[model samples]
Target: MARNSGRVGDLPPPPEPLAVPAVDAHCHLDLMDASVDEAIAAALAVGITRMVTVGIDLPTSRWQAEIAAAHPEVRAAVAIHPNEAAAGVDEATFEALTALARADGVVAVGETGLDYYRTPPEQHAAQQESFRRHIAIAKDTGRALMIHDREAHEDTLRILAEEGAPERVVFHAFSGDAEMAKVCADAGYVMSFAGNVTFKNAEALREAAAVAPQDLLLVETDAPYLTPVPWRGRPGGPYLVPLTLRLLAQTRGTAVDEFAAAIAANAERTFGPW
Candidate 1:
């Protein structure tokens, strides 16, 4: 018996059952350390049956399309991120992204928009131009537009209005004040909340979430990034979506089950069933 005391490798645990029907409206699964297959499997185990993998550049956009092609549950959103726009996106990059947007399983045309935090004023014009191009692509291709706005809400809103953005526009990881939320709501835009809504100083965010129209609300992990509280200090993935959903449900004064159902319906409406 003493001779058999050495530790044996632990058997892998069974996959957790999917909780509420959840769709990670935005995440960089392709950029994670895990292989695409493993990431999809993990996401499925957690009930994250669907995901939209976004591209920050031409190469990544191509990769996103490839992931979509291989995985039935994954969809692609092709665009040039604002920061990458500053480094000088070429016409060919736009062309390539446009082609990808039209590809099967490509659900949206962004993760694009303005980001003043990393882009300089000198390059603001280019960023805006790139954004307009993406909006046009969304319109022409009939794909939903996922906008990434940070510290550039005014310009972001202004441009979308001016460019005649498609009917399906989402403000991914919405980081705006109540006023901005009101503006978006007025425009009939969808606001997708990330884990940031669960932060201590996110009173405004919670308020925004509470007031958001029922049909327009969405939840996402933005994983490997803004992990929600309870799991805030840890690495994130589709598995943690329930934590965010619970917080969102609490903020909205609705049952978690109801909120989850609404979000799944919203995702289906915006990106279509996978």
Candidate 2:
């Protein structure tokens, strides 16, 4: 229930660095006010050496591609978010997004799936069309697919199976129970945990995290949103990933150092090397 005000000025300071370096599986550097270099440097100083900056639309997707191309520590994921999917994609925009997906340093095609929470029922068809196109693009380009499923789990999973999921499919900011976790695990999908898992009311998410296979488990900030506990509601960036990561480690009953290493390995497997 923590909402993002999108106000970055008053965010909390970064916590101490983790014992093992980690990659923020997902984030949006273009949404923040800080320069890309500054954000990368700040995260690197805290042992967050790498991150994937995602794009929700054509323009932002282009921005992410450019930034990732220039920065060694960054990668990009491009797609139109499910909420935006209802807007209907024009042929021109689809062409542009397709080009960006094949661009250098673009590691995935996603943050695209179904979101019934904020999107109206009238637009469900459009969302489904967009999701299908993204799935095809991911498969065509042979890149990972980062999915954003909200309140449309069954439909999302159905479409993924129907369209044939890409080799690497990640449920970013996974919002599901242990049952759903098993379904995704059985399908060889990655369940990425965001800061919301730290909330008191998110027992189901924690259970999902606990059941997630170590090799298939991933962590993300999804910033500047889903800022971890005590810092929830404040703007966040990759530097804040350790907070959620520590919680994930505890939920998995593994030492932070060991778990962090495993998460790093999982990132490599999902998005390709660094």
Choose the strongest candidate by TM-score.
Answer: 2
lDDT, candidate 1, equals 0.82
Candidate 1 residue runs with Cα over 4 Å from true position: 1-19
Q: Count the backbone clashes (under 3 Å) in each candidate.
A: 0, 0
TM-score of each: 0.91, 0.96
Cα deviation in Å at residue 99, candidate 1?
0.9
Alpha-carbon RMSD to native, per candidate = 6.8, 2.7
Clashing pairs in 1: none
Q: Residues 78-179, candidate 2: write the lDDT tens digits.
A: 999988889798888888888889988999998899999999999999999999999999999988999999999999999998999999999999999999
Residue-level lDDT of model 1, residues 1-274, one tens digit each, is 0011122222123233545777888887765545677767877786778888888888778888888988899998889999988766788888878888999999999889999998889999999999999999999899999999999999999999899979899999999877888889899899999988998989999988888898998888776677777555455666567677788898889987788889989999999888
lDDT score, candidate 2:
0.90
Q: Pick by lDDT: which candidate is best?
A: 2
